[model samples]
Target: MQKGKIGVSSDNLFPIIKKFLYSDHDIFLREIVSNAVDATQKLKTLAARGETAVSVENAKVSVSFDAEAKTITVSDNGIGMTAEEVEKYINQIAFSGANEFLDKYKDDANAIIGHFGLGFYSSFMVSHEVEVVTKSYKEGSTAVRWTCDGSPEYTLEEAERAGNGTDIIMHVNEESEEFLDKARLGEILNKYCKFLPIPVVFGKKTEWKEGKEVETEEDNQLNDVAPAWTKKPVDLKDEDYSSFYRQLYPMGEDPLFNIHLNVDYPFELTGILYFPKLKNTIEVQKNKIQLYCNQVFVTDSVEGIVPDFLTLLHGVIDSPDIPLNVSRSYLQSDSNVKKISSHITKKVADRLSQLFKENREEFEKKWDDLKIFIEYGMLSEEKFEEKAKSFFLFKTTDGKYFTLEEYEKLIADSQTDKDNNLIYLYTSNEEEQFTFIQEAKNKGYDVLVMDDVLSTHLINKFEQQYNNKRFVRIDSDVVNNLIRKEDESEHLTVAEREELSPVFQSVCPADNGVNYVVDFKSMGENGQPMVITRNEFMRRMKDMSKLQGGGGMNFYGDLPESLNLVVNTDHPLVKKVLAEKEAALSADLETVNAALAMLKAEQESLEKAKEGKKEEEVAAADNEKLEELQKNISNLEGEKRGKLEAFGKDNKLAKQMVDLALLANGLLKGADLDKFVRRSVELIN
Candidate 1:
């Protein structure tokens, strides 16, 4: 036996390795298994180069535990370290100065272990002592044993071995007794080694025998040596991708579609990304994409690797170029990482565009499930937005789909207003807004079903992208005003507007967080007597606030909804209400208006005389007379409006018209709805 201290500069290295070398002590198994894989791969390379006589068959890494002995062993059938090589690699921890190392890696344990040549030392994290018995693959090379007891001092000696391989034996410390549990170690192996290029055997495969699981003679291989990502895309079938998806997410729903990513130009990247049938909430489905380094699982939080939107996709992304062992902050600044991100976004956009072009029917069929992801990508990645425009679709309320370009052309002639703005009409709920959608369609206009959770944000993006184009919800405005080509001349004069405004306002629901303004429009006397509508800009901002969680726009969301009580003046029912209102309050309003008009004329004449002169240049008596005339005019107008308001309250037809409008818009509810129903019955009778 030969004894010597490790060549590390400090005696503090052992303690640092134990407490700060890995983020999780359980990762010790991953590091050890990874080393074993590296050895096996090297042996294969050497054999391929005619450097060794070893056969490549039955090459595997085996993990087994002896609970009674309180030890765990990971053995590999591959090129093993010779005594001299062990002394050089294991003794000399070739790393930075002690203080520099601690300062750099004190916060990130995995950085220290993965970046430094300390994969084997990580064994000390969960072990009291570690032993390495290795036999070199070179001919006539004798096997050697290395032992260390969590200290700088280690012993090397000659040992008897049957074949060229390596075995690491770990004496589990009392604090890490969990590592001795077979199930616990098996889980760790499954997480880290499930996709490694080597077959990892954990223990004997179990089968149900006599109603209880029992170990069978077959070995339980915990990993697949060649995952689908390592194979050529031409050799894969749809079902093959599906099977791989199931392997990655055992309990997840089957994906809607798969994009086999294989790129090898600027940087090498290979993996399968699947479009999941996501839930309504994006946050719930985020961080599903697993990142891998050479098939070794690194993390599921792949935000830095994939674009922010693509994180919703679930599957594996294996990139050897991505730094496997580094802090997340380091990854954010990696140029290769940024390139990979851009490449992935491009690939996803290309796949979607291809799918749309090849089989638009199929793409449209899956659109409901795929829309959220595409919208998210378009909103997040600028390049993706530019590419996605060709494939992203807008589904009409009539169950037809069209690309934005196609839809714009289809509606440009009919939906463009006099102001040259193209109106893209949409509805959130087809059933609730059925009347409004039908009205839009009745006017030879197409309405889109913009019902996705991201639709509000997405349409905002679209309006910015397409000049003079705006998206308006179907219920946001009256059908005529939604895409007005030429305004219809007002069929009602000012006197008519004054008489009907109070009649409609009186019946409008108060304290409902809605502001209703009465307006008159001509609709060929065939349109509905009344229609309730909201302003597009305010409604959109409020809807966006709800979707995006306010974000300082809560004022719009919290303010009462402003609605338009559009009373069609051409309708016969409204004409009857106008006539009745005029008859009921005509005498009172005329008398008040005569006095108000005379006072207003006197007040106007006095103000016109003082227009260009200073206050002192004008007569003080004239100013006093103007003020008295203004007060008298205000009093008479108040009396005139009060009579109209009284007539509005007593008129049930006016209230019925207002309630019908509210009911059509699905806004009348509770006591108002109940009253409308009862009044509707009485009016019918």
Candidate 2:
């Protein structure tokens, strides 16, 4: 027997492998099993070419655990290695520079997994010593046994009378005794080898006989040799897909749909992607989709392999093209992964489009559930955005479904402004915005309820895609201003406006966290006295910034909410308030107006003669006369706004209207809300 140091130039290889790799130590099982599978596959290829003597009809890989001997043995019926093959492959360390080897793979998990021809060496990670007993299927080959401790030294000798293939035994290490546990071994098997192409047996089937679990005579295979994804899509039924889903996730609800992805041209990719019922926000549910390489389990963390949105799906993806590696950082940059991601997105969009075209009624039934996924794709991927335009839906307040074009046509005649820009009105809450909805419906305009968190983002997307179209929240503005044909207002004289400002200002709450600018509009007598509304652009920007992004929020949130306190001056109640204020402050305002008219006439005469004069001449002319007129006018307006505030403070009707408007906007809360309710009761009584 002869042995040589592992062909590494430096002694630093062992420590690097132990520490940097300790994080992914569990991958050792996958590597060993994969190597076994590779050997087995090679035997099959040889047999297909008439190279083997043994009848290769059926070959299996068996894994056995011995608690008493503290050992784990993997026996595979594959192309066993001869003594010379072991000497060349196992005895010589293959003096290759370890740095160049490790440099060749900066982050590929597959490279370090079985590198340096170290498929069998992984057993040493968990075991203090490892033994390999082999009988090659080659003609005139002798059986051999190889042993190695956790070091560079190894021994090879003639030994076992094994059938064919190899048996690798690992003596459990002190630091890794946990792998000796039956349950632990079973868990590792289930995690990394549950869907192998060949049968992989772990132990015997257990039975609850004599009040205890006893090992049954039958073998307990731990895998489905022919998983659903491996079969032809035509050969499977809905129940089969459902069963496979159950097998993948025993506790999950039934998936809404499944897309069987089998592509070979651009890159080999096979999987069953299930659209699970995501009733709430997308939470990270790990181990939902198991990745496989040539039917050998690799890992469940497919974030790099699949798109971010696809993580919400649950199923299996097996590809021989994906090399089994140790570093995920390398796979993330793999060109093939991007191809796979695009293909999956297209396939998903195609599936939804097909479903909608084939059975629209069923698609409509699931639209509410399906909207989130389609919306996410549209917002994230530009390509998906293009495809989703065809199948995307718009729903109306009247419980009608319409495509974007259809909805545009339905609202075009009535909702379009003078500039021909179409307006799509929607509400976040049907109950809270009921009054606004009614007002819109009163004018023969439809409102769509958009309550999703992504609705703001989706609206932004819609405006970008649809020409001369805008999405407006139902309660954004009053009925007339929403789709303004013209700004037609009946002007009030300065004296008249000064009289009515106080009656409404008196009732408005000072502590409410909104700014109100009062406006007297001459609507029909039937209209409400006051309507509170906010600008749509400011409101939506503030909203979307809270989600999709976190920028410009301080700017928006810190700014006082701009609400228009529209007082319908034509309403009889408003007219009555003006008359009452005039009756109350007539004497004071009359005296001030008379004094102000005389002063204003003198100033206008003085200004009319100096319109084209130089600044010095105007300044010289404006001496004592200008100072006195300015002081008098300022004092009058100051007294007037103060009186208006005073009147607004005492006028319960005015306060009630302001609060009512706040309540309508869902902003009346806490003590202010309490006062509104109390005032509401008093008014009702």
| Top TM-score hit | 1
Q: lDDT (CA) for every model shown?
A: 0.82, 0.75
Best by lDDT: 1
Candidate 2 per-residue lDDT over residues 1-685, each given as its tens digit: 6555644556665555555643467656766776676567667666766666686676878888888899999988887889877776665553222224346434431212233365456677788888999888987778888887767667888876657888889898888888888788888888877877777888789999889989989889999978899888999999999999998888888989999999989788899999877653445667777777667666678877877777777898877566434432124447777888889889988998999899988887787777777777888888888888888888777777777767878888999887788988998878888888998899888898677777888898888877899888887777777788765666797767666766676666667676677777776788777888778888887776666456656577557777778888777877776776777777887777787788888878877877887867776547667778788888877786787677667777777767777777777789888887887898889
Whole-model lDDT, model 2 = 0.75
lDDT (C-alpha) at residue 386 in model 2: 87
lDDT of 1: 0.82
Error of 2 at 591 (Å): 3.2
The TM-score measured for candidate 1 stands at 0.90
All candidates: TM-score: 0.90, 0.88
Candidate 1 residue runs with Cα over 4 Å from true position: 14-21, 94-116, 140-142, 279-283, 326-332, 493-496, 616-632
Backbone collision tally, model 2 = 15
Q: How much is the lDDT of residue 400 in candidate 1?
A: 93
lDDT for residue 607 in candidate 2, whole number 0-100: 71
Stretches > 4 Å off in candidate 2: 21-23, 55-58, 66-70, 91-118, 280-289, 323-332, 490-502, 552-554, 557-560, 593-635
